[model samples]
Target: MPFIDIKVIAGVFTPEEKQKMVEEVSEAVIAVEGEALRPVTHVVITETPSGAWAIGGKALTAEDVQTKRAA
Candidate 1:
């Protein structure tokens, strides 16, 4: 079985978006690993607490990231 783990800041994506992401990621792996492996390919998406994840030694939440991006 192939295990795929994806981590992201919590609240960064909606439930529907996450589902799409999982499906897309799984499909990508299947394309490379073969169609037979689709049933056995495991994809895990984990969301860490927003402020708990950091960049450049600064802690920030998804909202902060979006606001900054808009600037």
Candidate 2:
């Protein structure tokens, strides 16, 4: 059996979008592996506040990008 796990940041995708993504991912997995017993796939989405996530130790937000562009 093949097991797949996908983790993505929350809020970026809606429930319906998430479902579609999961389905597509599962199908891709099946395609790679021949039709055997059964395959297991898991998708985990996590949500974080604007300041909770950071890159290079600096938090990034929509406003930050806009401000940088304006400057």
Candidate 3:
């Protein structure tokens, strides 16, 4: 079985978008691993809570992103 894990900050994607990502990721895996492994491919997406995902030693929330975008 093939297992894939994807992680991202919360509020970044809607449910439909996440589903699309799963489908597309599975397709990509199938392309690389061949058609036979398509049925066994698994994709897991994890969403970190807002203000919990950090970079550059700073934790960032969805509000921070919105403020930056407005600037």
lDDT of each: 0.90, 0.62, 0.87
**Candidate 2 regions with alpha-carbon error over 4 angstroms:** 37-39, 46-50, 60-71
TM per prediction: 0.87, 0.56, 0.82
Estimate candidate 1's alpha-carbon lDDT, on a 0 to 1 scale. Answer: 0.90
Q: For residues 1-71, could you state the per-residue lDDT of candidate 2 as single tens digits?
A: 65556544434556897688778877787777755623454444555555566789998664664466569
Report the Cα RMSD per candidate: 1.8, 5.0, 2.6
Candidate 3: give the clashing pairs: none
Q: If ranked by TM-score, best first, what sequence of candidates would result?
A: 1, 3, 2
TM-score, cand. 3: 0.82
Error of 3 at 38 (Å): 0.9
**Model 1 TM:** 0.87
- The numbered model that scores best in TM-score is 1
Ranking the candidates on lDDT from highest down gives 1, 3, 2
Per-residue lDDT tens digits of candidate 1, residues 1-71?
Answer: 88999997887788998899999999999999999999999999998898998889999899986687579
User: Model 1: how large is the Cα RMSD against the reference?
Assistant: 1.8
Deviation of model 1 at 53, angstroms: 0.5
After superposition, which runs of candidate 3 have C-alpha atoms over 4 Å from their true positions? Answer: 64-71
Measured on C-alpha atoms, candidate 2 has an lDDT of 0.62
